[model samples]
Target: MRWIEAWTKIQTLFIPGVAGLREVVQGTRTTHPSDQLQCPQDFPLLLPSLILHSVSYDRTLEEIKWKLHEGQAHNALNELCQVLQSRAYMLKFKDSFL
Candidate 1:
């Protein structure tokens, strides 16, 4: 259930950027404006690909390629979400100094 909450939070984090999101939900374009957005330098590249793979294993390679093209946007948000979920699982000690 915590994971569901975490995922919900992740979704909310992205709620404000529906301009690019609208294009996706409406299936009007294969490409998105957020595709041009930049991934944070501190974020690892492999993480997003892994998240994308896990969440959408059935997706075609072309679709994955489109989703991860510029290493930004929803891909990054999804990656960060998986990371957050993992950390939340360790909530008992997430802030412990020991």
Candidate 2:
């Protein structure tokens, strides 16, 4: 499915750096000398970008929390399953090339 493909791409391209950033921000991880050479510590623009991303992540999480509170989690999951099944059916139909 397209959504799954997109999620996989994000996991491959974006997740590792974010995880590293999180560790750096939390003071739990340090970059090796060679790693610093690749993404120098003195990069002036990095802080603002990291802050923006952190805020965006926080806002998204808050929205999901409220949405879950408004709807029963089980109902939300059932709706998701229905959507995925419908999309799968459409994909299969298209693949049939009729």
lDDT value, residue 80 of candidate 1: 94
Q: Write the per-residue lDDT of candidate 1 for residues 1-98, one digit (tens) a residue.
A: 45544654564453334233434543543257755424444222222344453333334645666767766787788999999988887885766744
Give the range where candidate 2 is weakest over 10 consecutive residues by summed lDDT.
Answer: 37-46
What is the lDDT, from 0 to 100, of the residue 86 in candidate 1?
89
Q: Write the per-residue lDDT of candidate 2 for residues 8-72, one digit (tens) a residue.
A: 45633533444455445534333454434233343322232345555334355456657877788
For candidate 1, the per-residue lDDT at 46 reads 28
Model 1 CA RMSD to the hidden true structure, in angstroms: 18.7
Q: Which stretches in model 2 have alpha-carbon errors above 4 Å?
A: 1-71
User: Each candidate: what lDDT?
Assistant: 0.50, 0.54
Top TM-score model: 2
Q: Which pairs, if any, clash in model 1?
A: none
